[model samples]
Target: MIRHLSSLIMDNVSNVKSFVLLGFNDTMNFRVPLFIITLLHYCVILFFNISLVLLIVLDESLHEPMYIFLSSFCINALYGSTGFYPKFLSDLLSSFHHISYEGCMLQAFIMYSFSSCDLSILAVMAFDRYLAICRPLHYHSFMTMRRLSQLVCLSWLTPFCIFSINIPITSRVKLCGINIQRVLCPDWLIVKLACPEVKSNLTLIVYIFHGFFIIWIYTHLIKTCMRSSEDRVKFMQTCVPHLTSLIIFLFVMVFQSIYGRFDSTDSSRIFQNLIAIELLTILPVMNPLIYGFKLTKIRNRILTSVYLNRK
Candidate 1:
């Protein structure tokens, strides 16, 4: 019985093309206000992420491997926001509800590509921090500019290569039957709709997305806690921000996974929508807040820049 069910899900479609996304809802009631709110949030995030990246790149003071990784993630964040926001803004202002199949696929690909890059970069940043704090002697030689540049390139390239393989698999399957139900046609939801031998894709994605990141971050974190003899206040200051970000990500992922698995129903659908908004909108707002307020370097940079401008 299990085998048969697996076969049913795993079979690849031979023919058919294109999909029509149902998209959150067709109601006129909530579209305009939601659109405006989403636009404002995305603009702020884009500006912050891009400005930070530029500042890191231009400022010789911020030229370390740590800042390099942060800049790379900032670029990914910009790409991530770009993939989803323009469509959302258009949908809100113009009431353009339809997306071409090509458009949807491209959107899904870009979103996940950036997201995957960000995830890997975050892991790399954590490792960089571990090396700096826990193994300070080796940090300079180990994380040089040349090496950091290579790592940044790899972080960007890795997702493009992996997603290129998986996207072709998705392209082979037709989306004629299933309808997407979100403002952004997220890759996860799109893959679920594509009738492919999807176990391989799902398994790979889970490994990359969930498995690697969770293990990598926490493992280093445990090592840091064990080794650090620093004052409690100093230790907690760094630990708390990363810990909070991780908790929020885990909570959202857990709920979203459960919501994805549930049968298509109104209540389940509502829960998923709520989760999506929080993941996209609320999290971006919190990220800058966490990093800006918690990290001394970032806080001092902002204050110094402000003071210098005034002078």
Candidate 2:
């Protein structure tokens, strides 16, 4: 029996090419409907995000700091959505829901970094709004195009570099199992599949540092917005949309995190899948919608472009 088990283990090591995603319930009769719903979700995500990104790029009139940041936000939405949706939708329709080891790592990298970068961009936007509202005279001086470009790059690159830490750690691990419990490769899920020695302290500190930085930025924005009625209006006008998006993103992240860690009971698979996917499904739509409708210049530009295209 001991020799047989050893052979089995060696066979698994040699033959394990992909992981089975156990998030879907094979007994469920709604796979077709589920596929349709997920397909529409992807379509909406692509429509809104790509439209806004094009709007920002084409309209030189909207080339200010806020719009530029909004463009970055939309692009990241596309990035995140693409990471999840294509594979997810395909899995929903397929008989076998499996992802290769390399594919799983890539998905986790994109998904995690997309989220972290979203938070980073939001933090930068919050700071920019604070400067524009509270220190109006110096806003232009401080947020010059060159500096704004640098901030944009920081927002994009910082999270990419931070999340890349996990890839090496995960790669070094000798995975014991070839089953991932989620539809997509979330970092935590991927990490869990690895051997026990992968210390998560560094990743934890990176997350904590990111959270604190975002909180600190918002704290200053709140303090500054308190002083003047005019600044209050600016905050309500611009920051409110950002605040709304931030709250939703944070809520989705927290909800998913909780469910991922604690909820192990054999419950509803559909509900499980929904919670796992809420962030990717929700944010791509929410970010572009909030910025598109709430920000006057973007709205107007979109309208003007639409009207002109009709002509």
Candidate 3:
């Protein structure tokens, strides 16, 4: 009897070649409108993020550490959005919402890394702001081009390496099911299908540390800014956008986590789908806009270029 049960479990594991995403099952009536709206949303994300990245790259004056970090942030947004939107749009138009095992894993990797990298980059940006505002005299000496390059590389590489380890660990788990409840495959959801015990907590710890560091830096920044009017103005101009982005990011993350953990069957499918895609949709569009409008140099450069081209 035990042997027979083991055989059945092995067969079940072998059968999970692809995962069926059930998030779109209830959207049959709205697929056309949904597709158009999602397409337009994706285009807007691409345009804004790409334009900001280009503006930073083409203009030499914007070559300071802050603008360089902003460019990296926008580029990461583009990377994250591409991983989600194309497959999502295709699934919207098709009857079947199936994703291959490889595709699902890749999507999860891209998304997980993207989020971790986002926090990492934000932490680096906070550090940059701390130096510029709190230690203006020593800012250039400390944040040399080489130091900036190392931080940028660490921001991108560290997350990618961490998630790279996670993907393989998840892949080795013996999955008992092939259906995912959300619009896209997240590693946690995939892990949920594991037939046996799966223990991993490194990513969570690393993320918590990143969050703590950012808050710590900002705490010092606020205290210093409060004492001086010049620092206060600089904080309003440069730091507000970072704070806004951080707030938006934290809000979306908390919302998604709550929904994912306590997701009730009675909840609306539309609401669940929105919650699932909120990170992809909102951050990609908002970050670039926030930075472009908030940063004086980038704002002035954009206006000057536009005015010149029209003439």
Candidate 4:
């Protein structure tokens, strides 16, 4: 019996060219319908993000530092959606499950790089709002077009730099015995699969350190906003979306870290399932809704733009 069981396990391993993505397996019967839904969501996010980005670029009235950073977020979302949903949509519609190892790595790199860039841009936006609200008198001079351009450039550049260093180092290592569990390879999960000697390549000490700086700056910005009684409404209105996104991101990261320490058992499988779907699929869908629609100004701008374009 023991020999038979061992043989069965080996046979299963040998025959398994790729692991089935049980991530969205819950929607098994509704794959086509779910694809349509994902398509609609992706279209809405793309339209709104591009519309806002165009509005900022074309309308002089919307060219402040706040709008500048908002446009950056839109661009990030545009690329981020492409990084994730294209493959997801394809997988759902045709039930295409096999992604080459290279393709999976590319997807992970693009997804993580875009997400990290979005975080940095949001931090910059928070700082912009902080200075504008806290120092109204000098807001214009301090956040001039040139300075805003520099900040935006830095925000975009920093993520690529970090990813360029970390992704190649981590992804180049072998994963001989590891099994990919989903339709996509998560960058961090790929790292975890690496053998011990090559593990240091995946240790993102610098990324973690910079992430803390972003959090610290954002914390100060939040405190500044809370302290100003006269500018309270405006501060909160501008800062709340950023604060919410940041909070949710940090919460997910914390949960992922804690869950990652557990044995690879049933509970870990549940955590993995939740993380794969929510973090990769749902988060991108929710991001534009949270940051764009919930804001009265952006909501109106998007509606007005769509109406005008239609006419």
TM-score to true structure, per model:
0.82, 0.90, 0.94, 0.79
TM value for model 1: 0.82
Ordering by TM-score = 3, 2, 1, 4
Model 2: per-residue Cα lDDT over 1-311, one tens digit each = 32443355557653445677877645247878888887887898889988888888888888999989998998898888888888887877776667887898898889888888888888888888878876789999999889999999999998888778767777667766666666777767766766563446665566667678778877887888798787788888899899999889878877877787787758676677678778887889888888888998988887887999999
Report lDDT (CA) for all predictions: 0.66, 0.80, 0.89, 0.68
Candidate 2 accuracy as TM-score: 0.90
RMSD vs true structure, all candidates = 6.3, 3.5, 4.0, 5.0
Candidate 1 minimal-lDDT segment of 10 residues: 9-18
Q: Name model 1 segments beyond 4 Å from true.
A: 1-18, 24-27, 194-217, 231-239, 268-271
Per-prediction tally of clashes: 0, 0, 0, 0
Using lDDT as the yardstick, the better of models 2 and 4 is: 2
* lDDT of candidate 1 over 84-174, digit per residue (tens): 7787777666534556667877987886676567566766766666676667689899988788888888788877888887777676665
Give the clashing residue pairs of candidate 4, or none.
none
After superposition, the stretches of candidate 2 with alpha carbons farther than 4 Å from their true spots are: 1-10, 13-16, 197-199, 306-311
Return the number of clashes found in candidate 1.
Answer: 0
What shift in Å separates residue 266 of candidate 1 from its native position after superposition? 2.8
Runs with alpha carbons beyond 4 Å of true place in candidate 4: 1-29, 94-96, 196-207, 222-227, 261-264, 267-271, 282-285, 293-296, 299-311
Candidate 1 residue 116 Cα shift, in angstroms, is 1.5
Of the two candidates 1 and 2, the one with more favorable lDDT, higher being better, is 2
